[model samples]
Target: MATVTRTTRADAPERSRTEHTGGGLRGAVAAEWGKLWTTRTPYVCMAVGVGLTAVFAFYYGSIARINDEPVQAVGKAPIASVILLQFIVVVLAMTTVTSEYATGSIRTSLQWVPVRHRVQLAKAAVTGAVSFVGGVLLGVLGMAVAWVPFRGHASFETGEAVVQLLSIGTYLALVAVLSVGVAFVCRSAVGALASLFFLLAGLPFVLLGPGSEVLRKINDALPQSAGDHFMTGDGDPYPSLVGLLIVLSWAVAAHLIGLAVLRRRDA
Candidate 1:
């Protein structure tokens, strides 16, 4: 005699739900990734981002010998390049979400993956992963090329330089994720770009302007300041850990708010 056992959905509701959620998330991620790469925007953005980094790295290296301190050029090359490339990252991230809404594909997306949170998480994951990998490649390339000007000489500590490279890559990726969240909240490419410009470009300048010491302290908490601190190895306003936490907190808060809004609204 043989006994056969079969599990029913009601009998294992928790397990069933967990499996369903996991499957849905994977499907959503794959779908988002496929959608993202199927177009030319991501490719163009990546090319521009890395291309600009290469240009800046070459420029820095070319002038490295002219400066009184050539080591400063080596240290600044990679990070400075990334700072300029961040705008492209912002546009890429914003377009990822806004394009869907613009084409009215969002309704179909919602229909396919009814779980709004999963969709949002999938998009964020793709954006973050792509940006992080691109940033790392760009940073490494910039550093390698910048070293050409130094002729193997250095003014900065090797350990710190290595740390800064990793930090800059991380900062760029975080910025991309933050931009993705902002795009979700804005739900429009133009609006999101305006918001990103204010947050990434305008705010830092305004905060850094001649003002009270209190304003300077507040400026340290801004995302650009955090990125600058990581880039320049400046631990004055906030420690590396604190600066990362500040940026990460903003990213998390933005995503949470966007998710809540997505859940409440129609596609």
Candidate 2:
């Protein structure tokens, strides 16, 4: 009777432990959402991205007459908003892990989730979801508000125009997830951010806009180049899907490398 009772007790604790981990994953997700909404990054990014997009649209709308084709000018507004809004998305994305690294809170995060891989995956998921929703809403609304002034020029209600707004959101989310992957791989605040900013801004300019034809082809195939698809309706030089895949691949590779490092390194 004593032996049987002891085995039953041990099994009870094992069952409870499994249940605890399941509960913990949910807790982790909730914590992520809380951190995102409460943290200054998301709020500021959304505000700046949305506000600037609106401002740019209005500015362009005001000068629509400057264009030889006024109605056509309306088409560029969505593109302009997306290009401008991505800047803010990049900033928030860098913050995803850099901020935790800067404050050393990531150590605590690892401690809480001992299985570091799960934690990082959870972080990536949260970041992507938050960024996508925020970016999409801001881009769509900003363009819509700007559309009021564009009334005399062109129809804003077109399907292509709708895709343009939604694409901004998708880009923002993908960029944020990529940043989180960057944060984990670099594991240093300043270094990660410096590299993140360069990739987001400088790299593309060097490869696509100013460099040689070879550089243009290389850059155009990259995420920075691929993102242009979201802005322009031009039939893809390759395929817009190609760019998105590249971005996802980069992010996945980084994430796996980071997971390896997290598993081996002392947090």
Best by lDDT: 1
Q: How accurate locally, in lDDT, is each candidate?
A: 0.81, 0.70
Error of 1 at 79 (Å): 0.7
* Model 2: residues with Cα > 4 Å off, grouped in runs: 1-24, 73-76, 209-211
lDDT of 2 by residue, 1-267 (tens): 355535567698898888787446777777667777788777777677767877887876666744635476345675666655666766676676778778888788777777777787778778878778876677666667666766577565578666766676677777777777777778776777787668767788777666588887777666666777635544667666666676677677767876777778746
Score every model by TM-score. 0.86, 0.83
Clashing pairs in 2: none
Off by over 4 Å in 1: 1-22, 73-75, 151-162
Candidate 1 has a TM-score of: 0.86
lDDT by residue for model 1 (61-168), tens: 777666645346366788877767888888878788899889999999999889888888888888888888888778878877777776644455678777777787
Error at 254, model 1, angstroms? 1.1
